[model samples]
Target: MGRVKVLGACPLDCPDACSWVVTVEDGKATGLRGNKDHPVTRGALCVKVNRYLEQVGSPDRLRYPLRRVGPKGSGRFERISWDEALDEIATRLTGIVAGFGAEAIWPFHGTGSLGYLQGLEGYPGRRMFNVLGASHHAATICSVAGGTGLRYTLGTSGGMDPEDFARSKLILLWGTNPLTSGHHLWKFVQDSGAYLVSIDPVRTKTSERCDEHIAPLPGTDAALALGLLHVIVSLGAQDERFIAEHTEGWPEFRDRITEFTPERTAAITGVPQEQIVALGERIARTRPTAIRASQGMQRHAGGGMALRVLACLPGVTGDWAIPGGGLHYSTSGHFRLDDAALVRDDLLPHPVRTLSMTRLGEALLETDDPPVKALFVIGANPVGSNPDQRRAIEGLSRDDLFTVVLEHFATDTVDYADIVLPATMQPEHLDVIAGYGHLYLVWNEPAVEPPGECLSTTETFRRLSHRLGLTEPALYDSDEELARQLLKGHDLDRLRADGFLKIQPGSVPADKLQFVSTRAELAGHDPLPDYTPPADKGDGLVLISAASHYFLNTSFGSNPELRRRAGDSTITLHPDDAAARDITDGAAVLVSNARGAFEAVAEVSDRVRPGVAATTKGRWAKFTDGATVNATIAERDSDYGGGAVFHDNRVEVRPR
Candidate 1:
């Protein structure tokens, strides 16, 4: 019996790029643990990832290629050879291009594995799709709105390093609950000894631990930010020197901020005037304050504007010049991947229309010119995660639509596929991983051979490209070649030895905190940092479908242990709202809107505001009734970045 430890990195769709050690005994994985040497990992894995071995070793994992034998969404398939699967996929895609043009083919990708080679951002099928002139997929489900807004103000989303948060005297957890979703960064927050404050609509686990929890109305973040700025300027806390030297359009912005006084902000945000005043005063007095604005906060109709307004707070206080004082949305901009070399967009024969993934149902159902005939789903389950679930499912049910999915499990999206290819998991594949939460890139080494005939996404695409008989040299590049191309000008040996590479943040004067007056013009917004109210105000409680602690966007949704720990799909409402609806805790309820409906167990609590209903996302349709919270969300786009408005939804809750 022999035991060995292999170094690898996590490739899940998380901000923390965790470095881990896999314990293998007799050629089988015995255990897995975090690398204590890595500052972000700190020798611990989150609750979701702690039980990842279950996911890797699950009996339900797809080990062989499948061809659907029953109707769509039947979850019935017959085992097939890789040659059969790849041949069928290539033939169907070629037929689709010949009959309906290449624009009919959509390569739908997602952030299942945030690796440079296998994930959505890596452009998994870029060379083939571009060479074939297929329609472009706009990846805007997650942080695009917030990142776009931050870029307009700060010229980049990269800001204060997570390690520098320990130097802060005040830390504002703005719409981000790092303890549940991103537990690694909490170590630095704990070490900071900072007066922590949580600004969210619901009292999350992180909020309960914070020194202050200010529950504002949903979709009213911009109002709260403007109100804070109003108080800062009123108290003469504004840094005149920084504003003069570093900012733009302050006079106009100040004039706009004046409109949002404490009383007005309290009315708009549903936060008490006194609480707003006190928090504003605290912000004015606190030096080296850090604001961590997450992706969830910018998932509303005015989400982009909300981020733009929140980003101005640091400039108003001159926190940009100090350590642990800037607004941190993401550190992804620092990692410069050779995207042109990898994506090969130059191979395109002509310009192709870009379709938004957020409005996937529309793209699938309502698109007219060259209706979508072929869908190549890569590492994404849109039927379970995308908005307007009914339309997505209905569109997928089309008998004429030829669909192919690359997945590890029989996900909701896989149920509707014509060909389902089994893909390798993190431990069974090689990838170059980067994180948005911190500044580091980890080389994910394959710890074990893939089970059965499973293949990595890169290998799958390479094989499919060959089966198509296309002479695209870039499409046939090896995984190692792709990794080296992405890690250009970096030490490969050092990266392999250390298991990670630190990406130094870019050094540019324009990268500093600076507001742009032209930002409002880009999205037809206000002249200055202004509040754009939610489009829908007509009815019942505002629904917020946030990230779950047990699941990472349907990645581990099939794990029995994780599912048991997560319990049934639940919707948490304030006691007052529950009483008004004549609903009791633990009762089955129906949450419905104009878009659709779903079933959930009601949890009556004071954790959420009266007019707000809260629930965690990423539950499978089979786990719940026939839909998840996504069913109730409309196909609406944010004011900026064409992002999904998941939080801008309104729904009614009643006894089932």
Candidate 2:
């Protein structure tokens, strides 16, 4: 009867990388809880990660290698040894490279883990393919659009820490549901005792808890920001001193915003003219104000431009000089780490062709020249998460396309695999995890032996590279060695022992102002933030596929307790919209658009405004009654950064 507690971190693709402690008794993990020592996590995990032991010890976890025994898209397989699986994969890939060149082998991956080493696109796993001269993947499935847009406006993405929200006098939560995703940040916002205002198309769970909630039309946030700017400048609230001393091209920006008066913006954003004016005045007058945005805003046609315009609020109001007073889109770029040392792009065999991850369906189905011959996937569920699920799945079902997936569960993507390799859960790997929402970098350590014959992604690829006979000394670095090398800017010893470290923010030139112009300025498009309408427009209703409180992207979509709480997938619409469409509550309704469509039970609610149907992401095809929600989404790229325009989707809903 022996019990021991081991420290670890939740390495999911979350902004708050929570530190945790695992209780192992009799050589088995018995309990898990958040580490009280972690300032950001504050001894509490989200609803999803709280039941992670079930995920780690789930009966359905893949414990062995598998080979297809039935038709594609069917969950049928026969167990195979690691050696046999590796040999077959190596031989097939070898034949592929020899016949069609290394570029033919397209390696697809996503943020299955956020660990510095093990998670985030299966780091070292891609090293093998890179040295093999495989096709280059533009991993912009998420965040890139918003992150890039904000960076262009702010000079750098560095901003106030989430914990610093307590110092603010007013907080604007725009396009973010902090209660579900950024819980720690929400706590600070609450503690600040400031006026909490939420501006989102949906009256989200977080909006429900806010002092005020303002619903704007999807893809129209730029108009909202511009409207605010018009009020701020007209009412003499613009920070004249800061603008004269630190900023560039303020005259053009000011004149340009006058066109976005409350009435004009109201027509665009669907918010009342009076509400827009009131909100704008409140923000301008509020000292030590902060605007915390989400990556979701960038998942639209005009997403990049929206963030760029929104970032200007702080500069106009002089919030950048004050702690916890600037716009906090992400504190990710503030942290320093040796990323080149970790991924080692210098090891690439040669320059390679590029493919867009946002348009996976097109890349898989329409890619030419040497077209993608063989597919190797790791740490991603593209079938469920990627837009145009039907096309993505159709490509996966191709008899010619040899597909492989490395995962811990038999996900929808795994069902179509020619080979399925077992992967270790978070507690079975090593990582130095960073957070976009916090200041601490957490050390993730294994708490128990992995179930079945699972292998870490790095080790699996390292073994495959050996089998393929590519002997670069750099390719064979141990996980510990890799971890130590990537941790140059931070204290390795302190992080290893204490399980967490508070990272200091990066320094930018004060004279440059927080906002740095990217290029030549003309009508807010060049050096200044611009407003661009979405290219796609539907006739009937608007559809937004966003993350539910239960799932973060596609990570923990299968846990029993979590999934039970999440209940079954359904489309939520305002009661008014449902009534107008003659859609009854709990009745099946068909939601469709030009790209594709899906059917879900109606849950009439005001979680989202009228004409907007809201549902969750990460539900696999098997979990859904019909097609996955992503099927209704287009495989479109954003205005900047090649990000997926998930929120830009438009659809019509009616009784099925």
Candidate 3:
């Protein structure tokens, strides 16, 4: 028996690139756990990663390359040799390029494979496509809007570490519920000793545990944020000295917030005027106050503006100077890694045409002339995650188009593919990870050989490149060489010895008012936080798509344990709303909008605000006639970032 080595870092979309330890008996992996010696994660494991054994060895896993035996989206396929699959894909794709312009071919991908090497920058796909002048995709689905907003206000999107939460006197969990989505950061929140204030339209698990819960009207977050700023300024709590020294646009920003009196903001936000005043006073009076915004606020129309408004709070009070008092969008310490050096741009012949992942439906179906002739889906399941199920299905169902999916299982997106390429799980690959939420860079070693012909993403690309006749210097190398190249200029000996590397820390400004003077130094847009209201408040009820505690998109929906934990999708409605509609808990109800309708189990809970309905977003599409929660959402996007307006939808629900 030999100690099974756990490779640190796996999963493309996750921020916590945790290290795992494998136990091997007779050359077979028997168990896996977190590497306790890793300082950042500290041996913590999320439920998704804990079930690696089943995921890697499941009988349902895709074990070999398979080509379509029937029509597209038919889920009928016949096993094909790897050589045949690669050769056929390359030949067909090349022909499409020869006929149509490079822009005619769109490669749609998202954050599913966050590893720089496995995805855009590190992968040879971008290089190959660029050389062929193929269409490129702009990976801006989840955090781009929020990232843009932060870049405008803070100069940099990176923020203070989550472990520094212990130094705060007050922490406002604005529109973010970390208990469910970011469990790794919860430890610091729980130990912070600060008063937790949850301000959201729904009463989530994070809100339930907070010292105070402020339920604002949907899309009225900017109004609430402005009202608080007004109160802070009125009380003379603004850090004038810090502002004068660090920031630039104070006078104009101050004048803009004058209109957001507590009374005026309360009317629009559904929060009490007195409560707003008190919260503002507390934020100003607290020795060190922190405001945390999450992706939820960035999912609606004007979402970027909402986040920009919230980012100004820390600046107004000069809270950024405090160790724990600052605006934090993410604590994943990915910026510490020298990504520029790791990204080998010269490997590609030219830049590929790009498309936005958020508007995948539009990009795939609405393109003029030679539309997306072939799609290579890797590390993403847009069929389940993209908004508007009808539109996504229509886009993916191009009759003449060929689709290929590289996956570990038969996901909702796999059914639409013409070919399925078996992919290896995390423990079966050699890789490196730079966690965005933490400062650890992990060296992922192959704990076990890929089972039954499963291949790493790097391997898949290597074979594909070979078939395509790509002769670039970078594309012709092995995975180990790629890793070494990416890790260039670093202390590799140290990383290999510890199995991880923590980037050296740097000096961060301690003066909360630094931005007041250094506003011009920030990265993008207006430095001062700004506020804007939603375009419309429809007569129909407002709908919000939130994540569940048990699943991450549609990826884990099929996991038996997770499925048991999250039995079925249910609509959470306020008692008043449910009663008005004659709906009761456990009753089946039809939720409909202009796009389409679907039946969902009703769970009448006061967790939601009146006139607002809530449901989990990542359930399987087949939950009800291929009915997805996103189907009820329109393509209406935010004015600034064009982010999906999931929170701005209007729908009606009735008993089924």
Q: Top lDDT: which candidate number?
A: 1
By lDDT, the candidates rank as: 1, 2, 3
lDDT by residue (tens digit), candidate 2, 507-620: 422235534464424324456566778766757767777787888777777766677888777899899998898988898888887667777889998778876778888776
Residue pairs with colliding backbones in model 2 are: none
Taking all chains together, each candidate's TM-score versus the true structure is 0.98, 0.97, 0.94
Candidate 3 lDDT tens digits, 93-137: 888878876667666765565665665435435655655566767
Runs of candidate 3 exceeding 4 Å displacement: 119-124, 331-343, 347-352, 504-528
TM-score-wise, the better of 1 and 3 is 1
lDDT of 1 by residue, 1-656 (tens): 59988888888888898999898888788899998888799789888888888888899999999999999999899999999998899889889889999999999998888888888768787888898999999999998888877777877777778888999999999999898888888889999999999999999999999999999998999999999888999999999998898888787788888999999999999999999999999999999899988889999988988988888998889988888787888888777778788888899999999988888889888997899999989989999989999999999999999999999999999999999999998888888888888998887888888899999999888888899998978889898888888778888778888898788887422544546557657657665667889987879999999889999998888888889989988999999999999999999999999889999899999999889999999889977768999998888899878998899989999998
lDDT of 2 at 171: 92
In candidate 2, position 508 carries an lDDT of 29
Which runs in model 2 stand beyond 4 Å of their true positions?
508-516, 520-525
Candidate 3 lands at a TM-score of 0.94
Candidate 2, residue 111: how far the Cα is off, in Å: 1.6
Model 3 collision count: 29
Prediction 3 global C-alpha lDDT:
0.74
